[model samples]
Target: MTVEVFALGGYGEAGGRNMTAVRVDEEIVIFDCGMSLDKILIFEKDFQKATTRELRKVNAIPDDSPLKPHRSKVVAAVLSHGHLDHIGAASKILFRYQCNIFGTDFTVELVKSDLKGEERYRSETEDIKISMYAVEPGDEVQISSKLRLEFIPISHSIPGTVLPVLHTPYGAIVYACDFKFDDHQLLGYKPDYKRLKELGKEGVLLLIPESLRVKEEMKTPSEAVAREMVKDTLQFAEEESEGIIVTTFSSHIERIQTIADTAERLGRNVMLVGRSMGKYARIAEELGLLNLPPGSRVYDKPETVARGLHRANKEKEDWLLIVTGHQGEPGAVLPRIADDELPYKLTENDSIVFSSSTIPSPLNKAQMYSLDTKLRMKGVKMFKDVHVSGHAGREDHRLLLRMLQPEYILPAHGDADMLSAYAEFASQEGYEINKDVFVTFEGTKVTIPL
Candidate 1:
């Protein structure tokens, strides 16, 4: 038995789309279908007008041209998590192959919401259809007589992230994308290392791990550290400032949970004011994962936000306001408030804690600085980078390699430079490049040799 591996997308950049495929003889499974936000921004206003081929040309979506030849042979499309860069392109692209979609509960809802937003796109593809299946951490998906899939729960910024493992007659293929090994994760269960080692003992033929932060020298901090950071900042602002406004990833329910618990302890009311926060909050609530205190307010609509802020302003109430726009997106809630479009007013000594990191692009940096200027002009106090990354750093990557002990190594979700660092690390661990360690990019395909 043999398996062919394809680096469909997410090869040469950061904050880009991540898609991978593994084919065992006649059956195939695609790992993820994310889109490049930078590429998509050029055609953002009229996404429906942009053809799939056009998106591919700009590298907005995965270069799925490689899979077109075996389109009908696709057995399933699986997403590792609900992050936009992991599941963004699935609703638009996977349906073209008429395959079943698999994800965790939150991720399934994310795909459904994406599809619902693309009504015109779905309408045009009248003959194409897809089904979404919700699979838990330990659930196994049987693709064909020769292939089986298992989702192993892993900790990330989001609540329902998983590491996918494919079991085939040839061997087990592990897709460890966008994860941090947090034994004390605040959101979900710890990394299933026992199960991972068990599968390793059964012989993992090919291991494709995300190398986004492999250059960092140590193991990544636990999510609990971020929670403490948030708590400390909120406590400080409660005593030292007039009001507190914080921003973080909307999908970070664990952070949100920490914020809510800490705000309650500090005797401040919690108000969530962002469309994305509302969407993810509702998704987590439905899955019984959100544990917000009763009476915590969520304002999704612009009018509702303005009204709530107006009331807070009128009462001179000191509340903890959680918002989106950590990257300073143009139309996000934080920018609107900074522009005075919202009813909220910034005043002296009011703290703004940034619990997120910028993607380090010129465009993102420019926007963030613009927002910073606006807030500073109003005398708003600022706190930044009070966060921990969700990717495996160099030490964690080394440990994972030791635990899995696969025959070959393939690094995904990073550019050539990052992959080069990872390749060197693999060599130090005794795997020779091009023979046991494969460093590939988008559109490159490899046939696994044992």
Candidate 2:
């Protein structure tokens, strides 16, 4: 038996995230097709100059020359999770390929929401039509006569993230992407160690793992810490303040639920802002996973949010404002608020809670600092670091290495330094670097023979 793998998207490259195409005999499976916001910004500013057509090409999958002939024989396009860096470009890549797309319920919902938004941005031919198969943890999806796919639940920041196991003719290949072993997760469930152990017993020939947190020496913090941070911040905030603003990742539905519950407990009316946040919330609500309070509102238009904020401030001291722009993206709601672009002005006593960690990208750090400084100048009370990461750190990666014990290890989903760190850790464990352990780059293919 022979197996081939391609780093179609993500690799040593820091940003434009893509990965994992496996070809075994007649079956071809694509793992992920995600984009890098940092790369997109660069492409816009330098390459495309904000041209939509050029931006689409920059964001799209490379020419089908890599997988074209095998398109008819493709079995599935399996997604690891809901994060844009993992599944965001699916609509662009899979539009031409005919295959069943597989993900968890929440992941599918998120994709649907994104597809709806993409319709407005993309050409009619480039528009997405998602043919999805929703599989929960422990459920196996048969791709072809010789291959079966299983979803093993893993604890990440988002719900329904999984470690995929592909049973091929030679042996099982485990694709673990964007996950951490957070035993103290607040929503959904924990990583299924028992299932992982069972898969290990069955034999894992190759393990493709994410190296997002390889530079961090310790285990990633649990979501519980983030929850407590939110609780404490709200508990200590001035109760007499007329408006309360909380900004975080829009796709973090569990965190959104937590914030909503906190608002309810504080007797505050909830208003969700930003187009992306409102879109995801609507999809989450439609899926029955998120049924916010009857009075909870979502506003995509800035004028509507401004009016609502004004009325809420005048009407009540307790009003919860959930918004976007946690990373201080220019023109996003939070940055606009700080820049006084919003119709309503931020008052001295008002609170702005940043329930997110600034991604270490230089652009993000600079923008966040600028936004924070401006907010401080306004005398706005600020709460920061009310969040936790979803990626596994060095300790978690070590634990996974011990548990899986595959013949080969491929470090993925990070920049050169982070991937090098992960490779170094594997070397310390006596794994052969670039032999039994391989470090790959985007567009490179590795073939394993049995």
Candidate 3:
């Protein structure tokens, strides 16, 4: 048997837009069709109305043209999580192959929601419908006679994230993108250590792991730690400020829950604002993954958001506003607030807490600098990086390497420097660069024989 890997996107960049195609003999499977948020922000195009070609022109989505010849061989599209960077391009792509889509429950629901929005915007002549299956952890799906897929539960910034395993005649290929080995997450499954060790014993032929934080030289902190950070920051800000506004990844339901609960403890009601923020939070609440406190409100529509902001403005000390645009993307809720385009106004000593870090992309860095400058000029108190990361660090990578002793390694999901860092770290672990440890970029294909 022979195996070939096509790094469609996200192999050479830090911020997402990740797509990869794996072929086991004649059959193939794809993983994580994500989008580049930095590109999307820079272009400021409405994704629902934008065509696939337009998105490709701006590098917002992965260029899947490399799969043209092998399109017929593609059997399935598996999503690791529901993050837009992981599943954002679902409607833009996934129609050509018309293959079955597989993800965990939350991921599947999020994709369905995206497809519904796409359908609303498209003409009747367009056909965007595709079959999607929600698979749970430990469920193994036989894609074809030659290929099988398995889901192993893991923790991340978002809920329902998994390590997708592709089993073939050669061995199992483990996709370990965007995962943290944390056991103290309050709202998600703990890492399935026993199963990972078993997979190690069963023999992993190739391991494709995310290399974003491999250079940190420490284990990633648990979500529980982030909870404490949020609680501590909110409690301190409550005593010093009259208004509190917080921003984070909308998909990070755990962090949102922490913030909401902390706000309640501080005698402030929670008001979740913005479209994406309300969408992800409501979905998680519907799926029983999140139980929002009673009387807490989510405002997505423009009219509702205006009304909510007006109420918060009247009683600034009594309400805590959770919003989008933690990266300072233009037109997002927080930035609009800074620009005075919204009903609410920022004043001296008002708390603006960022429960997220800058994404480390050039566009993100610049936008954040501008946002910080604007907030500081308004004399607001800003609490930055009041959060921990969801990605694994150097020590966590070491533990994963020891648990799943794969014969081959492909460092993915980062820029050139990040990928090279992973390769160097692997060398210290006794793997040879250019031998078993491979570093590849977008559109590059590598083949291995078994």
Candidate 4:
């Protein structure tokens, strides 16, 4: 008997996408049906207009062609988190496969929201149904008798991210990516070190960890640090002036919570400024993952936000604006405000804080620079990079290797440089390259030795 692993997507680069699969005998279990953004933005900005075949060609969506030979054996597809790179292509490609989709409650809601929104726009396409099941962390997910799966609680930028451990005859194949070992978290439980140690004792054949920040020498900072930073920035801004706007990733529920608390303490009424920010916050609150301050206002509709902005002008310090588009996406609230499409006014003495770092990309850099120029012309003061990454850095990576102590290691979620660095690091840590450590490219399969 042989258990095989497929590096369908996300193995070559970061931002989580495509498909990763495992095969045991005849049954197949897939993890992360994700999408990439480069080709989509470069070729076709509109997804509904682009055919799935074209999407596959541009690498916008994971090509499941590799799995077609064994498609009938596909038992299930589970998402590790709710990031777009992990779940964006689901509505586009999930219907092609017959298996059901599995995720945590928050992740399930995010996927359902995507499907529901896409259904409204895809009338020309054939009708398809998506089957989804919500599974919590610590739940045993049995795909087939040969491949048993379990969700180990983990922390990341978003809520509900987990480590997937697959049980087989040889040992367990632990899929650990897009995660951090955060014992001090604000919105979610700490990483389940207890369960991870248990997996170590049980024996792990191979370990796949996110290698995005493996070269960084420091461990990722705690969410609590960002919270304090938010509090300090808002307090300082309030003392100088009352008109302050904060932008961050919409999926970061913990960051949103910190913003809400800071606003409450400053006696400023919190007002959500974008549709996505509102939608994600509502989902988190509905799932009992967040508790927005009571009487906080949300203006998801453009017209409603315009009116709210007009009202906030009456006493700018009395209103705290939490918006989407920290990266300065054109459609985001900040860009619209800068472009004068929104009724909001950004004047001198107003504070604009970015609680996110500019993801390294030429497109992002250009867009952020444009936004920064516009705000600068208005003489607005800006604070940026007020946040920390959610990925595990070098120290944490070393700690994880020590904890799991797998016989083999696989590096993922990074580009060639990052992956190469990981291979060398793994070698230094004792795994021999090509033998114990595999720098797997997409479509490469690793067969467990019999």
The prediction achieving the highest lDDT against the true structure is: 3
lDDT at residue 176 of model 3 (Cα atoms): 93
* Candidate 1 lDDT, 1-450, residue by residue in tens: 658998988887777889999888888899999988666655665555566777777788898888888988899889999888898888768888888889998899988877776776544536657788999899998888878999988888887899888988878888988888898876775888888888878898888988889999999999888888988888877777767888999988888889888988988788888888998888898888887787688988867878877866654445788898898887788888889988878898678899999876667888899999999999988999989998999999988888889998899988788888889999999999999898988889999885
Residue lDDT tens for model 3, 1-450: 779999998899987799989998888899999998888887766898888889999999999999999989999999999888888897789876879999999999998888878876777787655889999888999999878999998988899999999999899999998899889998777899999999999999999999999999899999988988999899989988999999999999999999998988888889999999989988999999887778898999887888989989999998899999899999889998999888899999699999999999888889999999999999999999999999999999999999999999999999999999999999999999989999999989988646
- The window of 10 residues in a row where model 4 has the poorest summed lDDT is 37-46
| Candidate 3 whole-model C-alpha lDDT, 0 to 1 | 0.91
lDDT (Cα, tens digit) per residue for candidate 4, span 332-351: 79988888888778889799
- Off by more than 4 A, model 2: 41-53, 56-65, 120-130, 313-316
What local lDDT score does residue 394 receive in model 3, on the 0 to 100 scale? 99
Best by TM-score: 3
Give, for candidate 2, the lowest lDDT window spanning 10 residues: 44-53
Worst 10 residues of 1 by lDDT: 41-50
Error of 2 at 334 (Å): 0.5
Once fitted onto the true fold, the runs of candidate 3 whose alpha carbons sit more than 4 angstroms away are: none
What's the number of clashes in each of the models?
Answer: 0, 2, 0, 1
Model 4 misplaced stretches (Cα beyond 4 Å)? 16-18, 38-45, 48-50, 123-127
* Model 2 TM-score (2 dp): 0.92
Better of 3 and 4 by TM-score: 3
